[model samples]
Target: MSKAPNNQWWRGGVIYQIYPRSFADSNGDGVGDLPGITARLQHVADLGADALWLSPIFKSPMKDFGYDVSDYCDIDPMFGTLEDFRTLVQHAHALGLKVMIDQVLSHTSDQHPWFAQSRASRDNPRADWYVWADAKDDGNPPNNWLSVFGGSAWQWDTRRRQYYLHNFLSSQPDLNFHNPEVVRALLETVKFWLDLGVDGYRLDTAPFYFHDQQLRDNPGRGKATSGDAAFPDVNPYTWQRHIYDKERPENIGFLQQLRALVDQYPDTTMVGEIGTDDSIATMAEYTRGDDRLHMAYSFDLLGADWSSPFLHNLLQRFADKSRGGWPSWALSNHDVPRVGSRWGGPDCNPKLLRLAAVLQMTLRGSPCLYQGDELGLPEAEVAYEDLQDPYGITMWPEFKGRDGCRTPMPWDSTAVDLGFGNHSPKAWLPITGAYRKLAVNLQQRDPDSMLHFYRQLLHWRRSQPVLIKGEQSLLPVHPQVLAYVREHAGERVLCALNFSDRPATLNLPTGLQAAAVLDLPGLQGGRLQGGELAFEAFGGLLLSLA
Candidate 1:
């Protein structure tokens, strides 16, 4: 029931990611669901985002907290019903927002009917639906593939009389994409959603779609050696080169197929999550042509790297390699610590948050804004006893799971549980102490708040053609400064960021007359006369040169 728009807004647009479980709760169930999200779509639309990227809401056992989907076409009982999802789509469209749901094609929960049937016995009709193989001579796993959740990638299946491959937890088995039937079934599932009028999809764990058919052992990779990336490492999946286990060239065909499926519907688009260690390269590859993903995102910027040179180099590397493909940039997500907490440190300048918003909007590709980011929410501290994530529980202390980023949204400072729901029952992942002070209600009244800055910055970005459709060039990197130029049809803009904690002097190239200056924090006030640009600590300046 979408009143179709005249144009596809995904290209160079901003997408707001809403992790449903933590977004809002209408039923006072202490968990956000479809109804809660529908009610909040206006907030996203008002923020000037063009689309909404909702994480998985499919039926699941919640083993991986909805990442391990049990049913592709039906809504989880905990999340509501299919009718609720349809209502969400309609509401989002009426407000000029495109809805994109996460599609986890690489694997499914062991609880899925298909996986259950496949694992029932070796000769079951759906036996080939999941990845199965014989053990090596020494009775070890069939190959060296590492699970991101920890331990060996292969788990013995008593019913199948062999081992099944799992790139994550043993509870989530990898799908055998090599089987044509499997491909068709997954496509049908996608078609089911499309028929229900979804505007797009966000493919999860996109790189691991296809595995080595030979079940060959993965070569040792990137400073680690030994079995399946096992315990005590970052997600356990990083230990291997991952060349064989993921990022296979064959994945391009499936991407083409998925793209073809999307093409059947006008204006529908797909953005994939490439979680590979070499994510930039995979992102560039997956989105290289119109036949594949419309755009792809990687974790290159989501980590805790805040140095100016690092950001400059990362942008340069992506631009250098992604000549044909489009890139989608994200500063935070449900799986990582909020950028304010990760990068802002003890004294997070509100100005820097404003500058970050400006930078994201002005970047060359479509930007993704995670929920709670507009309020400048930092990472929450979760005690071990309060932990729920399998990934976090598996590796305690060394690497806490994603619960820090998945806390419920703080709407009011005085409201109990920060007004997340009307429940007297305790809510999961208690709202952080620091976040209570920065709640949306508090910021709405403060014109100079981070929320206001985001609103103003986004409004400003929309009017500038140079920002929306500009070609970017990284300027020479100085010690604590990073500069870049954006050129559109005829306009030229020079943007600079100062990453140091102390005031810094920037010597601009000669012959450029500074026409207008945007006063962003981390940048001190300076008259742009002559060719020199001076900045204060952590200041960022956007200049129009004539």
Candidate 2:
């Protein structure tokens, strides 16, 4: 059973995001399972993370990986039984780590019994449980809404001869939040996990919980294209403003109710994933009050723009807009490619990786570290034939999908399959690229390995109280340097990061004094003195101000 409530544990906490399908394989089934995760709980706790967020592990059709949940209450057989999940949760809690599971309440797999019953006939009790609309005069879709995966958001259901809304894959039908019954049912499902002792939920596409009742047409973006989006060049879903499709005003009341339920289990949190065009603002709005989300994360840091000027402006924008809400920052997740490859390139620079890790963990909000990021693993190069992601299959060549990042974790460098499993036919996804060299076993022995750098940074971060709940203020924006001062209880800590490959210097302003240079293990070659700070390439400075 969970211990006494500690509601404030999530504030500035370090959450390690684990992609369950790749973390470990205990059954020799090639695919990872709950037992695999339970066996590896010590790894997360040893890395000094306060919590772990498991990607969706519910019963699913595997169309969109585990994002398309079929059953809200049970674990999939492939991942083992509910007992297995219980064991994983118990083991995690024993290791002093909170467990957060992905909650896919916005939609359900077409294979769900509810969807099957609702589509059987219009007069069924659950007919309105999903967003079903009649075709327009031209027998076309109800509106111009497009699925985030591809083509139309509405699929014609031959049973009712009407269109059902699907913001993602066609197999995943959107739920109708307009129905009070639907809202109640979803909350009941969430309560199941709470009663089961999971710490919280990582709400998938949170803003998408409610959609416009009138089914209005989404307006197209006048000039914007998909150059810097999650799906670039291939997906047209980013061409529109996405106003009516998601982030409706009705969501606030629903979120409040959800929060109320989670609050009952004290210390439990709900961190929403906001992915609309205006994600930062939506994140702030969703988490503005204690009655809504406990915290929320946007795709702001998950993008390609890592320039100091860009980061400085982004932080300022978030600080300016966020009134009292909390945020969770993640540079990479199962959805995006590894930051090492995205930011550092094919043969990623471990120094830059260490620098990025420090920057993320030192940010104002709770930082979520994705699996393999601690090892500085670059994105794997999976062949087209080996691709399993439908998102990539739909938009091949230009965008090869998320399979590159979903490959199995490298546990041992000497093993033929990297020690993921023994007696298995083959790993679900090949352990390709140079990931073997960066395996956990190899890094465990190397004192200066990127893995060790993460352990050092995370362990040290826990000792700093000011970094936890401090008020963040940006320094004067520098073209190549991102700097901020976090103040709490009359104490101030300055964090300055150099985003350039070349050495950089910044002269401190009048009235500011660097009382002492704080020791940040793993991030080397940075000094602060004489009101003039100097940083080596991709270096950082953590100091106390006098």
Candidate 3:
């Protein structure tokens, strides 16, 4: 008999994030579609992921890819029809893997009917649906708000003879969430997806849903801090405190409303993306109770800080502030550089990849694994001519953009295009030669491959209830080594990871009886001698302690 479904499945679940355009291409159209995702569902289920979170697939103008939605209720023809989506959901359900989709609720493509109508004339029915403000006497923007994509956040509209707010590209306008009508309209759209059988949602730009009602000028940061080193320092978005622009307290009420709507559906969940000055605090606030988001994630783990102190401090800080909240941790995604290249640099070995997998899986929160990370695929080299990300295009040499991480997934080493799609069709983004050796077929045959290690790690994690739902306590160890203990229901496991590329030794906590050393390939297991534990370079071990 099958096991009963748990409504709180997301609490300690593992979610695999799929970038639709790069996952798999069906219909021989050189683009990944719903049918392709449905066909690839087995791979995810086999990988031990409890859920799959798909990026946006709504009707779009392709300005910022699918982030600029032109229609919320329909699927983009490039992706497929509504029926295709329903079929994908059905297939996922059959495999016991829940399906979640990205919901871009902050803004819409300028081509959206509402935006078009609002820009036509101020007297239109949808005029107040979007944020609009009057230009200053000197014909300048009303405030000092800056767009994330560069330039002022306000764009001029000749039809309305006023400036409109756009926190991103000029083609994408921010919605007026203060308006009750706008909030209701967005809720109706959310209901449409819920009715379509999606298990949950990954709220894109969740913190940007509401802006300061007074439209106050934001204060500026003195200089670039170490925290701002995550992305390229080409834009001014990172130079401000961003207090008035995002993470406004008023947004909490809207989140409550959203939570209420999702509560109407059983076994439904929502995970928000929180990016702001104090993202960790914001994550805690958004998920403080069941009245808002079920879980939230920040860019703390996704940044370039891979040191033992950095990781330990971040986890400890979240634990201190989380109270009863939940967090979702991700190492690599479509937005940033791949972890293999980011943390490992040029010499990112298979051992480091295995270590990363072990650390993420053993973390106390829900983990989100991005596509191709299981194969240890590094950032692909997208030449200047092939660059697609607008952020990279604008910032050129200083920041190469996110195109490197958004390349198509490699399936077959011998097949052209690596079996991502038909060989005859040209992919939206090229699959470079560097990923050929890391193809799925190639890795499947190698027991020591990163793919195999990831599979083993995830499967092993599922069997350890203490690692999944236990309370985590940081243990003292060498500065280059991270050690922690997870305990639940009288079961305790000690997890130790060496952050450096050199062997390290540390003394284990006393009064713990070692039961067995977890089996992991490509690295030496820890040996306890006179209460001292020794580990090899990039080695990780989990010990069952009583």
Name the top TM-score candidate. 2
TM value for model 1: 0.94
lDDT of 3 by residue, 1-546 (tens): 222243788977999999999889887788888888998899899889999999999999999999999999999999999999999999999999999999999999999999999999988899999999999899998999989888899999999999999998999999999999999999999999999999899999899989988889999885575273344566778787898888888899999999888888888899999888878888889999778999999888787888998888887878788897999999998889999998888678777878888889888889999999999999899999999999889888888889999999898899888988877437888877889999999999998788887887788778888878988989853588899999999988888998888888877767766787766554455666656778788877778785
What lDDT tens digits, residue by residue, belong to model 1 across residues 335-399? 77788877786677766666567667778888999999999987888999999898889888888
List TM-score per model, in order. Answer: 0.94, 0.98, 0.97
Candidates arranged by TM-score, highest first: 2, 3, 1
lDDT of 2 by residue, 218-261 (tens): 88985566444465655888888889999999989999888888
Better of 1 and 3 by TM-score: 3
What residue pairs clash in candidate 3, if any at all?
none
Clashing residue pairs in candidate 2, if any?
Answer: none
Score candidate 2 by lDDT: 0.88
lDDT of 3: 0.87
Task: Please rank every candidate by lDDT, starting with the best.
Answer: 2, 3, 1
Give the residue spans of candidate 2 off by over 4 A: 1-5, 226-228, 423-425
